[model samples]
Each structure stands twice: as C-alpha cells, then as structure tokens.
Target chain A: MRINLASIHVDDQEKALRFYTDVLGFLPKNDVPMGEHRWLTVVSPEEPDGVELVLEPDDHPAVRPYTEALVADGIPFTSFAVADVHAEFDRLKGLGVTFTQEPTVMGPVTTAVLDDTCGNLIQIAAMEAPAS
Target chain B: MGDVFKALADPTRRAILDELQERNGQTLFELCTRLISKHGLSSSRQAVSQHLDVLEAAGLVHTRREGRYKFHDLDTSPLRTITDRWQLPTD
Candidate 1:
C-alpha cells in the first residue's frame, strides 16, 4: 500500500551517478553489479528512508524516443518534493546545475525545473506551510 | 514511446500498472474488467490498450502470447531500480 521505489532512466549510469550525487547531494544507496550495468540507487540525504530513486540505463528500445520527445517539448521527466524549492534551486544553481524554469509560486506550491544532464529534466517542488 | 515518467504520470496508467502488480498475469479483457469493477475506471478498451502500450514501452509491463491468449505481467525490475538506487542503511 505504501510507495517506496521510483526510477529515472539515464543515458549513462556512471555519469548520472556523478550528477545525482555530486550536484544534487543525494547519498548513494546501492551499487550492485549486474554484468554490464550495475543495479544502482540513490537516496536524498534529508530523507534516507523516504524513497529510493533508481538510476536505470536507457537501453530499452522505447526509451530514447520517449526521452527525446519530452526534452524537445520542454517537459520534466519527474518531479521531486523539496522542503524549499527556492533554496534548493539556488543551491543547485551554485553547483552548476542548469535550470529550465526558475522558482515559480502557484498558490499552494512553489516549483522549479532543472536538467539532470542524464537526458531528462527534473522538477523540484514544495508546498507552502499552512499558517497556524 | 516508453517514457517511464510519461507512462507513470497518468492516474489511469498507474491504476493499470497496479492491477498487473496485484495479479502477475492477466489477459486484456481481465485487466479491463478489474479496472472498471475495482477501480471504477471507465475507459474504453482502445484507451486501456493504448495505456498498456505506453506501460509496455516504459518497461513496466511485459507480455507473452500463449495459444490464443496474450497475458500481461508487471516486470517490476524497473521499480526495483528506483528503490535500489536509494537504498537503506543495510549497506
């Protein structure tokens, strides 16, 4: 019933690992060998037990067209929930992460989109804290 | 095309995936029935088929033909990749 795992198909695992960890600050969770491709995963250091993001290889026949079309249309592959989108945006920008959309406020939520450098655009979003 | 995010982004598609996960192997008719009865989804056969095609492209689903019946199964390896990447402290 509870959700735990999610995946992001990357063009290259090693390169994706570097961007996800070095730039995004996610902690490496798993790195099991799977022949040519290793079974890899990463966790947000802030929420270690929250959920795992899989860094999968985009070797499947259907993946390329799927990713390319989205990229061409300027769509984010998936979004991550953040405590503060603005702060995370600034922090990530400082680390040379390229952003497609700057922090934007829309009623109850704030969001920003960035390129993962692994052939996908990712979004970071946050909800406004309710007033007491 | 099998965009994992695009495949997963839709509520109906997610429901279809859930159906396959709960029951490993099911024919198209069975899936359509369960989706309507259990999830109250009112999509047409064509719509469900299209969604299944999307999921298949995303590698979330696998299919095989046995005799006259084609059955669908949730591969689940892709799901594991997501969770495995963000592993627990057991490492």
Candidate 2:
C-alpha cells in the first residue's frame, strides 16, 4: 500500500513551515484556516504527484502527546524516500543542515538520519538492491 | 492503538521495515545497529525482538528463522486494509 502523505502536529506552525519548506525543499501546497489553527501542507518537489505533508498544530488531545513524545526523543514522525541518500545528505549539509547520522549501508539499502533542526530526526534512504 | 498504524507510526520501526522491504530478511542486531544507532540510542536485541513481536501481532511484519537468527521482513498485506480506509476524491 502507498501512503499519499504523512502529517505530524507541530508546536509552532510558522517554525514548522520554514523548516519543511526552506530547509527540506518541500513546496507549500496549502494554508487554510480551520478554527484556532490552520491546515498547512507541503508537497515534495519530486513525486508521482501524490500526498503532501500536512503541518498541523499540536493542540488536539489526540495529537499533542504523540508529537511531544517524538520531539522529546528526537524521533522523526516519518521519513521520505530519496533516489540517492548520500547525495541528498551532502546537498543538505552544504545548505547548512546538521545531520545526526551520515548515510550508511544497511543490508540492501543506504540510509541516513538527520536532525530536522526542528525537534525531529528525519531519515533519508535509497533502495540499494532487490531483496534476495 | 491499532497494531498496523502503531507499527507504522514510529520512525525507527518504519526504518527497520523499510530496510527489510529492500532486503526481505535481516537480523535484529543489523537493523538495530543500522537504524537505531544514528539516533544515539541503541535498542537491545531483546527490545528489537519485542518490536518484531509487536509488528507480527499487528500483521505488519513477518519473521522467518534462518539458522539460529530470526529474520524480519515487511508484510504489506495489512496495508491494503489501511488503503481501503482512505477514499480519494474523484471530483
């Protein structure tokens, strides 16, 4: 099954916006006001033109604790795929991004873990070879 | 919480599954060292085994015994159920 988009609630919408758009290179897809907070989203530059990442505010009871726990532990809410994880890591590094983990080979894939610099650890990975 | 979503929710678990997706069978220690080490936190072999148990219970992953080690792999069949829940707008 395919996931169209993955979303996580943020404590500060504006910070989340800048991090996702400016730092990660995702394009802002929508910003709609929905009560106390707005429904903001960003889509990947490369896509089959599928799901956008929804930057939601962590105010709802169902979402607040989950987001908080992930942040406290530096665990990313989700990860996105890349064609070349090593190149992506280097490119982001040149842009002044700090990575928590460099790209390393793991079985049949090469993966890298990085700090989103926004209270999350985002992973970038590329498929290496077909499974045996 | 529902098992499948719970299995998919955590980034570490997701990474482990992603690794397995590319290489269908992997030892818990290999997954732990590759996926969890970057976070500066390492899950023990027992903990990884437990996570595998949780995934197996959720029907999100499958395990096979190879020699003395158990290899874990992604089982995307349950994801079809998750996909069915989301209805895309044709209009």
Candidate 3:
C-alpha cells in the first residue's frame, strides 16, 4: 500500500488553510464541504502529487486534552522534512512563528519545533551526512 | 543537600543535566532527544520526566511555564553546598 495522505488535527480549518498556504508555503489540494467542517488538505509546492496533508478538525472532546498535554510538554504532533532546519527556523521566526525548540543537532539530524497556532506543535527536521 | 546527592546518583539524571548545560533552556522532548541520540540513553519519555522531577526536587533544575509550553533550565547553585561544606587547601 502507498502512503498518499497524512493528517493533523487543527483547531480551525480557515486559520489552518492560511497558515499552511501563506505562512508555511503549502499548496491547496482539496476542499470539500462536510457538514459543519470541510475536508481540507494541502500539498507541498515542491511535490504537488507526493502526499496530501489533511487539516482535520479538532472538535472532538478528546482532541483538546490530547493536544494540550502534548503542547504542555513541548511534544510535536508530527514532523515535516526540510532541506535545512536552521534556514527554515530563521524564516519561520521572521514571520512571527514561535518555536518551542530551536534548531539543534541531534546525532545525524538537525531539528526545530514550532507552534502551528492551530493547537499543535510541528517539528521540522533535516538529515545531516555522517562524517567519514 | 542529601536530596542533591541522591538525585545525582542516576546516570540518566546526570545526562539530563549535561544536556541542559549545553543549552540552558530545553523542553522535556528536547532533553529526551538529546539523551537518546547523543548519550545513547534508551529511557522512555515518562522515565526522563521522572528524572526531571528528581532534578527539580534537588534544585539542580528549574521548570518554567511560559504560556502553554513548559521549559526546563539548569541551575548549579545546589552544587555550592558541597563546596561550602568542604574547603580545598591552598599551597
């Protein structure tokens, strides 16, 4: 089976769309009206057909507690691969993004965690080549 | 002071302090990541958190709540108790 879709629970769909597209630079892929909410999704501009990220609603009673606990502990809900973690961290910070963890080298990877503003923390990471 | 020595008895707790020394303010997630990746610690997140509690009790680590996020910071003042009790002789 191929993995074509991934999802994150966002507090607000409208706000999530703006952040995913305008702030984080993802392209809109799908938007279907579904009762009180919409089936909203976005794809990376670089890989339009690679994978779709669903902006799922966090209206369920359990979602708030789950997300809040993770946020309180500075745990990210999910991670996105980036070309350069430091560059992305700087760029996001320029746009008023709040980071829970700064760009730090962890063995073979460099990572940073940022607040998505939709009730979840997202991690950005880049793999570094091991020294010979 | 006894609590300080008891807390320092664990290797994982000391590793947490070392990582905090490298970067003063860190989240539990960051500390756990550093311990697993850099120090080869296989402890779970909950275990690391309990270690943090021990450090906090010893006054070697301080936890701060900034808005919705909580951060851990290293504090070495407790170590001074050791120096205050025993003085080194000068040549």
The digit string of per-residue lDDT tens for model 1 on B12-83 reads 999988877776766565566567767788999779889989889989888776432356889766666556
With candidate 1 superimposed using the best TM-score fit, by how many Å does residue B37's alpha carbon deviate from the native?
32
- The sequence of per-residue lDDT tens digits that candidate 3 reaches over residues A98-123 is 99999999999999999999999999
> Order of candidates by DockQ, top first?
3, 2, 1
The alpha-carbon lDDT assigned to residue A15 of candidate 1 equals: 99
| Worst lDDT 10-window in candidate 2 chain B | B64-73
The order of the candidates by lDDT, greatest first, is 3, 1, 2
For A4-105, candidate 2 gives per-residue lDDT tens digits of: 767776768889899888988888888999988888988888862769888877667767566545433334557788888988998899988765446778
User: Which is the leading candidate under DockQ?
Assistant: 3
TM-scores for all predictions: 0.57, 0.54, 0.96
Q: Which order, best to worst by TM-score?
A: 3, 1, 2
- How far residue B78's Cα lies from its native spot in candidate 3, in Å, is 0.7
Tens-digit lDDT track for model 2 on B1-91? 2478888787667767776776665545446766654444467756766777778888877777643235577888888777689966778
lDDT by residue (tens digit), candidate 1, A22-102: 998899999999999989999999989879999999999999889866654346789888988989998998988877556
Interface RMSD for each predicted structure: 16.9, 12.0, 0.5
What TM-scores does chain A show, candidate by candidate in order? Answer: 0.92, 0.79, 0.96
Query: How far does residue A46 in candidate 3 sit from its true spot (Å)?
Result: 1.2
Off by over 4 Å in 1: B1-91
Of 1 and 3, the candidate ranking higher by DockQ: 3
Badly placed stretches (over 4 Å) of model 3 are A129-132
